[model samples]
Target: MLTKDGCKQLRDFTEKNYKETISEVAEGVWFVLGAGHSNAVFVETDFGIILIDTLDTLERGEKLLGIIRQNTGKEVKTIIYTHGHPDHRGGAGAFLESRPEIIAFEPKCAELEKADLLQDIQKLRGTRQFGYSLTDEEAVSQGIGVREGITHGERRAFVSPTTVYRQDTVTREIDGIQVEMVRLPGEAEDQIMIWFPQKEVLCCGDNYYGCFPNLYAIRGGQYRDIAQWIDSLDKIMSYPASCLLSGHTAAVLGHEEIKRTLGNFRNAFEYILIHALEGMNAGKSAEQLASELSLPPEYAELPYLVEHYGCVEWTIRAIYTAYLGWFDGNPTNLHPLSPGIHSKKMTALAGGAQNVWKTARKAMEEKEYQWCLELCDLLLSNDETACGEALLLKARALERIAEYETSANGRHYYLEYARELREKNKKG
Candidate 1:
């Protein structure tokens, strides 16, 4: 259950920075297409425009193409995917049907087609572990469009690249400019940086994007190799590019600005690595390091290195876990109770959901946000739609914690829920 105060705080905080972000960083040569964390690149190739990232889907891609056509009135000559992340390749079908050439990193070609999560659409879509928390029926009914996230491998059959680059250093001449593709590992495994030597523009697929990276895969998949991510970023630092682009977010312009931004990003990742290594040497548990580690001043001061999607402390835990298995050497946590089972027992011990709700209120009053969230999660998980009062309280509680959150993703999720809850009750 959520407290009243938490709701008010969340609403106010959300309104504050909901739209205060760069939608497009348009330089004279290249225009940033995606707002916040969604964007594709269009380079002015001699024959026409060479696009990097096709957008999320055919419809979204067509709309983005309309935007491009409005400026240049030229066809997309080719499509170069940064990686296999759905956001980057979703629009490829739209482009490939029209464009003459399609290219992608070879590793990504294999990754996108892999059968584990992709083949099992039900498990990927409905299961909480990997996919979004949505049933296939609900997802389709909502007109949420292609089940691409769940149907990654199925969609892969539609997107096999004719041209694949297997080497670390691959260069191709398109129209007039020379494009360089360097393999890397970050954000996604099949990653690359597209560099234009003469134009001095570098499209950093997902690497070196502002903010701390989710070093470990959070939505549950393969844990990202942080060591490889670091090595990839360090190599990109060697480039002398005037213009820098991100898969999402604003672009960094000018050679100096790009250098400074890349340096900060590099330092942040390195810092996380060092701290995680040190904690491991000291035999620090993942839970302890997660709570204890703080973003030091040097990396914290950089505006681009904000806690948008990833936090330094959490990244350290991720890296630690990536190296050292999950056991943490603690016998107690070695075999812990599962979430559903644990929550049921906890509710019983606390005198049922109603008492848990009352205790939640006390926790909120005492500013014990973590405790309040934990208890409220149990209540909501057990009976949210039926337990109207508890559901309302849970919304309020999440809203309160949203106020203290600086990350854009965290804030949006809380207030969005609160808004949804308000509408649900209003209709009821």
Candidate 2:
């Protein structure tokens, strides 16, 4: 539950960053931004319309289709997915009436197949990450964009790709339009960018958004290849694109601005990668590197590099884990005590659980919310039978921390956990 002030902050953030609108980015290319988060591109060609990446859920797809109908009566002939992300290709069922040829990279189809194998767990984690249970007022923006129409509707309406491309680059002439789909594995292994040479427009899906790229999603997924991500950005820069259509946020119009934004974005990633490796080689743990590493003012101050969607510390930690396994080269961490036993030992050292709770309360009074959370965790872990008050305290600490968190993903996660804790307290 967000306080009035917290709600206001989120609402203002959304209003300033994620306003819903549709606009013509190029001559015949129209960018449709739905509910702030999901974006779909409509390319009007000679024969019919070419749709790139349908919005998530059946309801969102239907609404987007209605919008398309209003703009042009041309039938949708082809649908291209930028990646295997549900938000990118889940709404293909909405465009099936025309029997469009749905196309996706071969790796993307394989990724989707892997996702289908673990659909139940993925859906559960995704729900919590996206704050599906959050009310409209409580759920503000998804950092990249707004949170509307993302998880709505009972049926997702996903349609499998009819055409799969295995090559790195596939150039096809659809409806008298020459389009190139280039594989750029960054955010996802199957991620691809659509380039329209004649139009000077580039649709770099999930590769470049408004804010810093989510090199690591807390919702949990496969490791994003940092090297491939940097290479993809370089590939995108080689093209002289006057208009850039991103998966999220508004389409950037102007070659110079796109170049500058992409350049800074790439530089930020390189800085994190280089510094994280240096710190690891210097015998610094992931925790130490995460705490110390940060982007300089030049990159940090940029709007695109803002830690809204992805934090610098999270990326540093991810880089460390990717290069070196979880050992951290610490002998003690090789076989750590179980959380239950560890908490019990700590409580005994503090004289009792009551004393630990008192200290946590004191920490809360001092506004050290993170410390308070750790203390409360100790109490709750040691004695579940008498953790009612400690649970409430932890919930309060989470709310306090969430009020000040800038990243939407982190904020929503804290709030959701707090809500869960409060519910457990009631049931207990």
Candidate 3:
């Protein structure tokens, strides 16, 4: 029933992201089977099962549904969404029609409701930079992920929450099982967690997945509240959890293990968020600030806080925006010249396009990526095709720097841009 392109795309995606092992944590509790970007956890009772997270795609969901059926014949009684991200909720359509009631953290509902307001915050910042003349394939090929990465953040018109809860704390008994949710205001304004008190089970959701928490998604939105994220970590630490699960990645078990990992996570978020604010408050320029700052030694030592999603530096910027708007408090920037206007003026002042290109390459050679990228943007904006030479150069420069990237999102951005340059050359 699928078209050739659809089939190929599905096959490619699946091969890229299929899980081999699904863990059975305990009786009536199973880690929802998945690998990469999404996870689902199911809790079973005499009546039925409560599922958390719904895979990432409808196609992916269909595959997960088939897998879930292979595991158990019982019907799902409810679905709990930890947050409103498409990766977490997009695949819910398959689960809903199958007869499960949907439950979501109340703040996630707010996130989903203003959902229209939530556009892929990253992509908005990116495409608005040039235009969507860039296709998904084009974006992917160019290594231009992040704000202009692949998918639309647009919510799929599918199953939404049937019930919601509000407040910093909420608890419930599900068929004699006690679950507690503590509101964490970091990642999203209304985000919280679903904790199984009786079981010492903590489903941190997107909050502390193995990957570096997406402290700042390139697809723009409100700068993620890192301070709130740290506080959320502290709250989770208070729980005597025997097992800790995330929206993606494997389940981490044992009180000592969970405590150690969660402790590092709290420290990392606190370190990144606090340092970013402190640097900005001290009047450090963006580039100067990034150079001077580093993650706390303790956080950098932990494997749990690895940069799978959010980069340490970008997270700092996110904190910067959270504390102060984008202006950088510079009066000169209050009425700065526009990109096109400024680039032209800078070009004229520098003598010519070639002069600017030469200077940028020099900065790049010295490994001053920040300055190099800044100049490259100016040249390219003046005339993209004219700056085609610089575009290819920028890509090469980004590729090397990306090797040092800690977060997948940051690497995606650098690599995508590099790929784009290569593709453009082939066409030219």
Among all candidates shown, the one with the greatest TM-score:
2
TM-score, one value per model: 0.74, 0.93, 0.78
Q: In terms of TM-score, how similar is model 3 to the real structure? A: 0.78
* Residue 113 displacement in candidate 3 (angstroms): 12
Taking the candidates one at a time, how many backbone clashes does each contain? 4, 0, 18
Ranking by TM-score: 2, 3, 1
Candidate 3, position 288, lDDT: 63
The true-structure Cα RMSD of candidate 2 reads 2.8
| Ten contiguous residues with the weakest lDDT in model 2 | 1-10
Clashing pairs in 1: 2-393, 2-394, 2-397, 6-400
Please provide, for model 3 over 1-428, each residue's C-alpha lDDT reduced to its tens digit, 9 standing for 90 to 100. Answer: 11224223323333333344576786667786443246778777667677777776665556656666667666677788887776677777777666776776565323334656555654645543322444444322111112211254433334878877766677888767777877776666656778887677888876776546667767666556666677788888788888888776578899898888888778777766666767787897665666677776677646556444556666666666667767787799899988888888889889888788889889889977767878878887785325467777788777666555444445456666677677887787
Model 1 TM = 0.74
lDDT of 2: 0.82
Compared with the true structure, what per-residue lDDT tens digits does model 1 show for residues 307-414? 644556657667776789777887888788976677778788878777887888899898787687677788766643136665677678766776565543344445
lDDT of each: 0.64, 0.82, 0.65
Which 10-residue span in candidate 1 carries the lowest summed lDDT?
Answer: 137-146
Candidate 1 runs further than 4 Å off: 1-28, 35-37, 108-159, 335-358, 376-396, 411-428
